[model samples]
Target: MSAKKNDDRKSVVVVGGGAAGVNIARPLSFKLDATKYALVLINPRPFRVLLPATLRMVVSDADNLGTTALVPYDKIFHAENGTFLQDSVRSIQEKSLTLGSGQEVPYDILILASGLSWTDPIAFPDSAEDTKAYLVRNHEKFAQAGSYLLAGGGAVGCELAGELKDIWPEKEVTIMHKQRLLFNDTYTDRYRRSAANHLTARGVTLHLDDTVEGLPAEAGPATVLTKGGLKLSADLVLKTTGPTHPNTDFIPSFDADALTPAGFVKVKPTLQLLNHPNIFAAGDIIEWNEQKQAIKAGAHAKLVVQNVLGYISGNGSSLKTYKTGFEAILVTNGKRGGISYFGVLWGLIFGGWFTALLKSKSLLVPMFRKESGLV
Candidate 1:
């Protein structure tokens, strides 16, 4: 703990401990020379959810899920070698980090792999009418949980409606798709037909090609009033919307303003920020024009770590570019299934049971354990 002892070791600070941060750190922690590199992790959550598997948890499948996903930091990164402080990061310098607790950490290299926060109706109250009355919890607020009005109608929304129908037959589930249906990628008519038929048959209402304009009181408690004067009752307004970076508001050193027009970090081909080669980023935070994937995020982290290692080895930090390729797992739960689009090969396993089991089965406990060095 002495200053002299600390000064003798090189340090690498990583912000965010979710998928990208954990995966990157786990591999590098094992590869780096113990005496040469030190990892300092800053995060707020005690548990990182295995997001793809959360559908099962929504239905209260906590027993098996307890072991499938969720890794405690102590188990994942252990033996008193690395450090984990349960604090959110505020901002980052080239080689330093300012945490919420006012502690400043310096690193030889830095990985800004923080993830994004999902936007719900309440999060942007000004956009909709009476959205406040809908969402209950600040974190898990869903207006449709006990009522009838649904928010989004994409993959998350669609799957959730199906699950609710399966579990609670009498309860009404409404899905508001912004487009016709799962328009992110094209699916064969058979896939849509099977899914639509199954959901409709189960009493789940599919409202496609509609956007929520506002929520009024009369349309209260599961019913939402849209811009087109259409009123629908919904119990829970869940959001399966994608993610964007969090914590960018605090970055001061670089032209943090260069973050994309939509508020994401702009990185070069090598995955380093548009500026500040001393720092790099990955995961949902990076503004890449493509679908977000864990494998790509991991690969970006690897490249960043490699460049960091090169700098340490006195080999000159010339980094290799990070390229994104397609990789997907086909998810089929209930009756219908769609192929997840990976670049070269697409894997298929469909249905709600399989869909939930595909990614959500692991509570991420073991993965965290392995990442944290518990194994």
Candidate 2:
């Protein structure tokens, strides 16, 4: 809401070209005075990834799903619109960024949305080509597998089981979790029951309260041992377990106290770093007390952009504060079925074709394409 002086341009650098960076940079590019502010987006990947669609890509036999999820950076940003640096951040100085390519980037304001890491074969690839290759490799493995075991009953695990079952109905698919609920300590009891019922209807075996002890070190199909003394064999076993690593190691000089024990950067309600006001954070890298969903990240990006403008223009009051809102989750079962839970006390659940129409049909790929300016 604040305007900067047009005499000298200010550099605003955004590290990580995911949802947070793109949402922040793209909107600010049109809102901010081009002559007085420059927006620079830095990410290792050549394209912005729509992470939600990854589960479908892994389970389906199609190759186009993964390709459609990766939107090119050139389509989103340009030299005139903003600077897009296709490189990783080696380290972060007070007001500068050191890229892996040995390039130094200075900025008056910085937004860190570098994201986090998940287990292999499920995590996003490094580049567009890598994404394609990853999808191809995993699709082949899935197609050839007789039995699939999904470790963890989170959204990813549930959706994966459903997709696998939908694609190969005769194939054996099981979801293993250490807890009773499908969502496992995240959602309410109602949501948990609903998810369990949906998966049950889809013929996805649920091994609740079961822990996977280990898998063989062999390269091919092998037996999996469970801590509960259960042994199961699967042609493919994918672990979507918790304990994700944050991508904040690049900021070695950052105040350790400003980071959570889990390593996520802690920020004020205004989305600025607590210790360093000039630095902001959003997306999976933030320590926000909310589900790390793309919708939430996009909302966070807007607040970060507003705060960054206020911080650089010397109008601190112009910065807006973020408030946690109604929690919601959309769990898609496949092309024709899914579930959506919104709110807490008065939460509403939607299933069947309604949920499929909302997500499963195309996994919102068209929405992402338009969001990244690909259209």
Candidate 3:
């Protein structure tokens, strides 16, 4: 962490260095006037984890996948105007933030991009080495397991099943989702069916509308009992039922009404907190009616950048409003197969070839590396 220089410049502090946080901080580092503002980004981790490629990393022995996924934050700032602090925020006040190290950082502008709290296989350990070791352990366990049971038929669950089948074709793989469709009802039935068919063609079993009752905590041979009284046997069990909640426990201390019942921050069209103009939020933490993808979080960052700069420019009236555009998602089955859906023109869905060429081939690892200044 860089020592804060004694200056009169106002501070612009950004919390959480994930996709949305980095996107907002990186641009502000260049665009924000250093003479008028001191930019700082606070995150617990030293590196950003490429979440989209994590499933492939755990299922395959591709060493480079893990290496490339965890990008360092050394080169995120273009100059000396910005500082990256590897610290977690303990609480947030009206005009300042208290970190876990007992240091209080005052800010004229604050952006919350804390994202969500995910389980293992999707979420990794803090340090790069620990995360790599964790992935290696899971990979070994996956190799040794004779069968796999994945709870929830969302993107993560489907992708993990595909990766497992791709690696061990003879291994029995089963997906149990409470919903009838693989994805949520936000997508067309035709698109969801197509995605399910792709997985089924690979001999992946689907147990739709059946909820798993008790999920095993450890990886071992066990029989999982579902709510529908189905006894499923598997050597390993993984849960991809999405994140537990938005990481906003500290927000209620500052403003109780700022968060929704689900704990996500309530933001205006400009992505600013409803009652606090100086505070803004993006990523999965924001109350946006769209798919919580990294791409959408990046879009939120861009808009927040424009609005934050505009707010400080003494022209707050002209802040741009964020409008949720068409819903689009690309679900990768494995390294060479997947599905793509664009909710436009009565919903257009693409098959494996297009998805493979677009996302499955490299999982956009190279693009993220370049964006993080690794390339």
State which candidate has the highest TM-score. 3
lDDT of 1 by residue, 7-82 (tens): 6678777787877888777667767777767877767666555555444434443354433544457655535567
lDDT of each: 0.59, 0.80, 0.88
lDDT of 3 by residue, 184-211 (tens): 9999999999999999999999999999
Clashes of each: 49, 0, 0
- Taking all chains together, the TM-score of candidate 3 against the true structure is 0.96
Model 3 CA deviation exceeding 4 Å by range: 1-5
Per-residue lDDT, model 3, residue 228, is 93
The residue pairs in collision within model 2 are none
lDDT, ranked from best to worst = 3, 2, 1
* Runs in model 1 lying further than 4 Å from the true structure: 1-5, 59-69, 119-147, 186-198, 215-220, 227-229, 316-318, 327-357, 360-375
Model 2: lDDT to the true structure: 0.80
As a whole number from 0 to 100, the lDDT of residue 184 in candidate 1 is 50
lDDT of 2 by residue, 150-242 (tens): 888888888888788888988888888888788855577887888899998878889898888875433237688898898888888877664
